[model samples]
Target: MCRPTAPRRGYDYRALIMKLSYQLVEQSWPLAKEFRISRGAKTQANVLLLALSDGEHVAWGESVPYARYGETLTSVSQQIERIMPLLSSQTSGEQLNQMMPAGAARNLVDCALWDLRAKKANASVATLLGLTPASTVITAQTLSIDTKERMAAEARTIGNAQLIKIKLDEHDIIEKMEQIHLAAPQSQFIIDANEAWSFETLIQVLPALAKLNVALIEQPLPSNNDTDLATLSSPIPICADESCHVSADLAKLKGKYQAINIKLDKAGGLTEAVKLMQAATEQGFIIMTGCMVGTSLAMAPAYLLSGASSFVDLDGPLLIAKDRDNGFTFADGQMQPHSSAFWGGENNQTNVELARLFTS
Candidate 1:
């Protein structure tokens, strides 16, 4: 039989322990409620709420499902079911990482632990994680993919935004960029293809987008097909969204992408998200913090990384028809911190009311 090793120096093996569990919730919003490279078709987003239980404090986390990641409500529930047994037994973040594959389920559970830890210690997530708080970070407000005229109209409405993230499909690359530039000439533009374009189409599109002063183009090619990018070049920097997850992906993305968009769900949670951010920075990749469509709970952990990112795209809550009571406040194209009723704030809920809402 194998024996456990002695505890490491300066480590508390038994202190600050917690247990976590998850539930799936499906929410429906109107067409304009979701912003993406593809227009919303009566948006319905699935969220997995992660609840962490310390002896005295409880924390919650939410994960938004993305179809591109092979995740649906049923699939995420199954993933969580398989790992439920380990949530209460795992003693450390490293141990939790080994128990589940990196994805939305793990992300929610991982973030909940971070929240639980923060509450137990009465510290903010940033302070607990050794990161500084940002007063106001420039965020990219997304314009959903639509007809050039419609997209232009949407862009005009968000004219106060400093950076505009335009969603594009393989078609109408020039027309969309032209329309957006004409409408919001003063705003910096960023294009996200969401792994929808091919190398040939990307080549055909970059020159027009570059001329329009697009600051960045994200995930133009599908993740599996990204190797083809090394052979091509463009004026606007390319950022890897689907291509990057944990720190393990950094070596593979070296010359292919100038930046990487880090989402809490993709990194499996805020704990690993921070690790991946530091690793990406050391490897010389510009950082962007992004999110899938969900409420304030989903965006909370990502706020911890805003200080290190060049582009902040945690606008998911803003796209929802209605959000949690303490959801982020977005106005004049700027995102403000959540109020005390949400995570990282005073007077936060002491019980798992959100979790019970989904479970019941």
Candidate 2:
């Protein structure tokens, strides 16, 4: 007979990304930020910027508006409203998750804690996380889903981008892929299906993607319907985006996906995200760290995780029409974390130029 296990010491290790009041900011894009095959009608995606201030130190984070995840400007705000009382009582990031279920609110608060901690220590977020600061991490410039002609034109315009992430659905996939590949043959390509492809379509799409030298395909099937993935033979490794959130989502994805797209919002914060990266790597899954649409403050923590990631898509800040002051630098599809933007750094001519070129 097995002996009874002793009671665990210390705090229970599950509840994290909790305790933080969120402020939902509705900002407008001068023009509609279009993507290939959008599911919503919003020209502007509502950004929920979280602020976690513990009297002296303050931190900020952002969450993109995703309707597919059952998120909206109103819904996210309502969720935050319900958890407002619970957030103010918590002290550390480790005990935040249990306060509220995993979603964007926890993501923002979790990220804010990392920022607040980094600021209070007077260290970069990377240093705080035990990772070295990186000069640059290659990012994927997105080409909005559209007709071949329109897409080719957009591809030509983003001449500085090293890699182009083309958003796709099941329709005219080869036509769109070939158009971009033909137009930007030298530019590397990655495809994100957003869980829109069926197994049959994936079989049809993967071969063409490989032929075009497409680097990777993201979340081809819906997260709940990944059972068929392991059995099928494919030309390219499929990464889990919607399927994999925090490290806890890893074990179930073992045979189903070759890689995981780690997003701070999905991981609930950078604290768990670091652990998520370690767990994914230990399990032999390649990491691709990404972000949803938000400001530079939101992208900062995700930048810290890039060193170990196989692919980096922290280009959410790049997609916005405007960003807050002292945001991180992103040029030619690469993201560089700032040393002390939150502390100092006035907007200047170069910053204006950077903003105009991308934001326009």
Regions of model 1 farther than 4 Å from truth: 1-42, 345-360
lDDT of 1 at 118: 65
Model 2 misplaced stretches (Cα beyond 4 Å): 1-32, 87-90, 343-360
* lDDT values, one for every candidate: 0.75, 0.69
The alpha-carbon deviation from the true structure for residue 19 of candidate 2, after best TM-score superposition, in angstroms, is 13
Could you estimate the TM-score for every candidate?
Answer: 0.87, 0.83
Point to the candidate with the largest TM-score: 1
lDDT of 2 by residue, 128-160 (tens): 567853578888888767888889888888866
Prediction-by-prediction clash tally: 1, 8
Once all C-alphas are superposed, what RMSD does model 2 give against the true structure?
10.7
What TM-score would you give candidate 1 relative to the actual structure?
Answer: 0.87
Location of the lowest summed lDDT over 10 successive residues in candidate 2? 344-353
